[model samples]
Target chain A: DKKKQLQQLDNFIEGVLQEALEEFKQVE
Target chain B: MEERIFGTECEYALFHQLPPPSAQGSGKTAKWSGTSFSENLQEMSHLLVCALRGQNRPLAGEFLANGGRFYIDRGSHPEYATPECRSVADVIAHEKAGDRLVQKLVEEAGGLMAEKDIPGRLHAFKNNHDPRGNTYGSHENYLVSPRAMEKIQQIIPFLITRQIFAGAGKIPHLAPPAFSGEDWLPFAVSQRADFVEHVLSDRASDARGIINTRKREITRSGDNVRLHVILGDSNMSEYALKLKIGTTALVLRMIEDGLGDIPAFLQPVQALKVISRRPAGVHAVEGAGSGHTALEVQSIYLEKALGYFSSHAATGEEKAVLCLWETTLSGLKNLRISPSGVIEDDPGELSRKLDWVIKAWLLNRAREKKNLDWSDPHIKHLDFRYHDLDPETGLFERCASLGLVDRVIEEEAILLAMEAPPHNTRARLRGGIIGEAWGKDVEVLVENWESIRIIAKSKVDGMHPFARQRRSVNGLKANLNDPFEGCNEALLKRVRRFLDKCDEV
Candidate 1:
């Protein structure tokens, strides 16, 4: 159960950073 | 012993990402100008200050109804000093509330800007350094006894290692690696480590050090002094903030109770820089061990604190701080970063609880995802955005929205802290005074942390009998000399006595 939650977190963080990077690029 | 008082002063960085002239033609949202730090940030800060309703201080800042202070510090950074807190939880709630307060002002200022047709998003970041290598501060203030002040050096080793958990993490241009040249350090554990040049210096802006020796006498009894700490980073994580303040207070308590003979760093500033830049490496914590890492030094402090508090009565907060301190150290023991500055292994739960860990993990993940190096400008932007205050665009806020990060304080508590001061400390009186004075038909000036001065708008009736006879009334003053006193009926009486007579009311 913990591992599954951890996987979800990893996905969440990656998605967040990915979106942030792309958005930042457009502004730059 | 008198109830220990704790406070945090955070100077938040203002970032304006102005859309270029070419992008103005497009429908996309604005972002930071290619410039590292924009000048509009200062103007935007001014807008926030101007939107505040009443003058709360004689200076440029306002004394908040929450018993806190918000003002623009040098370099035009918006700063918030949390009300004096006796508990770690209050500190966390109030500190986070500062972020909310500034953010609310940012929106107000943005509205003001819209009237002016300013074409950019004003992003306020709770961070220490900008991309241009200029560093500000997130200073801590604790009321320690005169005895603790004498043995202040005993706390240095613990502080130097405290960055293992308390650091807000930064990606630096002039990165410090143990070896120079091609060995590029892409990220550091601390934002202010490179700027700190001494162990104990009275100076703050330059020759910065572990302890800011500029002292303030808190009580007339000469029992307590304000230990102004300028070494830490502005943290976004409530858990990190709690542990940072909690453990530092505990160590200082131990020092007061005579927990002498702890480890000391031979070269304090040098060790701070090296350990911050290279935490996972085999760096010996001098005066402690041949193989003692930063983790070891921190553990020694924890164990000593544990021993002392085991005999001495500790609050539930202090006990919890000890547990978190230990767990964080244990978690940092497993922290893994490659020599090239990519995080090899991110501690799962600790990443949720600490600012630096989560930041390092996210930045490392970004680097690996795009096959980018540590020095990539894209990664740098993401790094800067991690501290961004906007809930929609901030990377950390995004993670928080998804419940990826662990929270120590409740959302309700944070919101309440925006207007209400902690009930147990002199902040309550200060907040009450500020609250009573707000919107009252009086000219009020908060002279400093200790006193609030108020005068009536109407001339004759507002005056005291003596002042009326002499035709000389400056104002009524409420000077809260003792921080432990939470209620002042006399001050409230004076508040009523003056403001009630005002015809403007």
Candidate 2:
């Protein structure tokens, strides 16, 4: 269960940066 | 005045599900390793058409015996458009018939794949958007008198708010964590709402609009313009489909009778998103006062419709719609959903009758049992399975088989709708010809909705002395331009003439 907690901490940062970068590129 | 013709087109997502490779624990995919599913989807669509056509050879455009069109749409979307219907019940029945027919074709495709030693199960989804940002359409076509366009603004608000009941409900497969928490809406009312980029646009692939301005088929005679609505979701709930079409038709009747003074949304796109994203929250409607709920806006249109029908000579269908509209409005007022992504109160059974509520109820229970998030894989799988066309496995079908959701039509009606066209419209004539000819070995080509081309299906060795006579009748095109044309004696005479010539040869 504590190992599950380790993965839970990463949900916010997961794929957000790549997704935002792709969206910004689309504006061009 | 003549009854208006109504039609519906549903673009389905065809895929074959394969278990993920044993080495990788990634989710299940509807693809082969070397080939993308999109490439296979095209072949799958052709296989479905061929199965229905039976050795008649695959033409990319083939009309079914039931007077409906089944063909590969813009992308890999296998589309089925219901025949023109004069009555609301006929539209619902025909649309349901389309689903049954599509499911049967999907089964046939699965069997064909199995025979060829393919590794997966083929499934078709009557849904709007995919895990990626791609969206297909579930479009509605209402034949309006030419002058009805001038008063179209009067109904935009009604169209925007109609999603409260009309929405097919979206729970994305790849929902990001941003929309996950209790404060943000985990579920959207309409899947197509956010994809509507314009108020009116001709482009359907991109710059999509609420009312697709592109004229799908050329309406030459009767001065009719088909009002093509692309915003609707492909409904699994029959009651939702009936209310959506029936209510919109009644309001169009009001507009045709020159009923004006209905308020236009100040920013329709903004209003559409707000109603879809926050169904229970206070809506910031532009001119008609802020803080009104989605139900209140629908009430405005419903009240006006009730008043108009009271004075006007409303049909039996119109009267039933008014009753349903009033009751549904009252029911919606009593229904409540909490911010924690759960249905708190649905006293009026709107959840059972509407798609969004039915889904929210199911999703809420699943979450409560396992304490799962909105983006959880289990919840997403349930959402996708709900719209699956398979009766044995689709969640909606299971709910329907269990008598959990409301059913508006009977099994017999849907079966009949599959084989026969609506008795009242030009489709009857078209369907009669298709069924009569296809029953024999005669090959017919449906060039478009309004035209049919027929040729004598024969063998080269079988060519006889009367080959010249067959040539006279071959490639004869019949144009049934009028949507109101009945299957009369004159049309039958011409069709019989062609069939007779082929027989003589």
Candidate 3:
């Protein structure tokens, strides 16, 4: 369970940054 | 007074001039020569006055058919309906009207016109001397709850992107029937302005296509549940100009409402204009045509407002900018009613269905902890709940994923219970907030305990307002008896529909 929680934490942060990056890409 | 009442009852206003008849040439014995533009306008105006006086047609017609057309100039907006003048008889009546105003101006100018005293001189007023342009336009929107923006932002970009699909393609050039290579020439650009030009110019273009493809046409599916606006007296203060700019303000609010899924470009566009919640530095795009019906003019002003607030997002005043945007589209002309009873048009029924969707979604979302609900399989693990939640293979990630799996399973069941397009309800056109669609919905929900009593209380109690104390605050004037009392009636109905729908499942 600890392993899964830690993994999810990493994935979530990764996903947020990815989405933010995706947002930034089309701005110009 | 009778004439005024009769004119007001007419269905639509004409914004364009009708083409002159084809058969009339310069030298032919003047047919309908007595029917000059000035005479027609005078006749029309007189007809109204006479009708109001309870005069019958023959007498009213005699007053209207005043001798002939008069050519006089007034610096009125082009869209203001003014008839053309062609005869000497028309000139006399026209000069008399002009005399009323011109006599007050610098006497010399008025005297010179009197001396020149010819229909030709009066007609000169119609000449387009100053080319610099400005637009006369209208803005429209429907009222939705404070919470609608968050949901709408998730879907508007998808609507914007599909413009090409719903819009007709443009072809610039034309070939003969037997020429063979192509039937039409396509335009270089696909945005609305360019499309409007091509459609208007093309002989092959179909009018129905333009109407059907308009973005203003409601989307059959989306988070947009309402559209409303306040028709400002444009002659009023700069506040009216700001009201004109409210469309962009609304877009900014939608961004802040955090419905997400909106296109990225719109986010920064709104952010760049927001300053401390008060929008500043918003600027309209330059060189947009000032045509009354031009979307370009509307969009330009809207963009300017967004730009101003977007560049100043760091200030505390930015908060008020959202308020400015929230009331955008408060005034409009066409009164839409979701009909009642067993009648059968789904479009008419959209208001209640949309109300139900928004209310249901909000309730469902409010009950959850995540920013985006993981109820659907398509949305599984799509949201991050807390700062500590990580995504690189941990228990939290698995928990999130497992939550999504359970939600997706649950969502399938919920979707089954969800209503389909048109939702099997009928909408009818009725007077104001009293119609069947709104009336029944309100009747069903007004007694419910969980309803937003503030909305009802604001309408009935007037003294206590919902949002707060400010320039927009409701004083004793806010009572249900006030004209704005009618505005809340619709809101009350929508709230009721939402509550009832929520309780059904």
Best by DockQ: 1
Model 1 misses residue B165 by how many Å?
Answer: 0.6
In candidate 3, stretches whose alpha carbon ends up further than 4 angstroms from where it belongs are: A1-28, B1-22, B25-140, B150-156, B165-185, B188-263, B266-505
Over the stretch B253-349, how does candidate 3's per-residue lDDT look in tens digits?
4444443322222232222112101111122322323212112223333454455456545233334434443332221112121211111233322
For candidate 3, what is the DockQ? Answer: 0.01
Per-residue lDDT tens digits for candidate 2, residues B1-505, read 2388899999988756654456323432334542123547777787787677653522324676678888788877888899989888999999999899889988887778767666667778888976555789999999888777777777787888899888988764344455444434678889898889888889888988888888667455567889999889999999999999999998888888877676666677877876777776555555667556677778888888878877878888888888988888888888777776688888889878999888888777666756777766556656766788897657677667667789888989999998888887778888878866755546787878887767777542233323344455344567879887866777677677667656655
State the lDDT of candidate 1 residue by residue for B1-505, as single tens digits: 3368889999988876665556563433343344335466677778889766422322213778888989888899999999988888999999999998888888778778778777666778989887666788999988888899999989898888888899988776654344443323457888888889988999989889889887665454346888888999889888888889998988888988898687666677878887777775445544545756688788888889878877889888778888888888888888666667656676646778888888877787677767877666677887887898888667787777777789988999999999899998778887887676666667677777777777766664423553574465646667878887787787677567666655334
> What is each candidate's fraction of native interface contacts (fnat)?
0.12, 0.00, 0.00
lDDT of 2: 0.75
- Mark the regions of model 2 whose C-alpha exceeds 4 Å error after superposition: A1-28, B23-31, B34-39, B55-61, B172-184, B282-286, B289-291, B439-441, B457-475
TM-score of each: 0.89, 0.86, 0.21
DockQ of each candidate relative to the true complex: 0.19, 0.03, 0.01
* Candidate 1 regions with alpha-carbon error over 4 angstroms: A1-28, B25-36, B54-61, B176-186, B217-222, B282-291, B340-348, B462-474, B503-505
DockQ category of candidate 2: incorrect
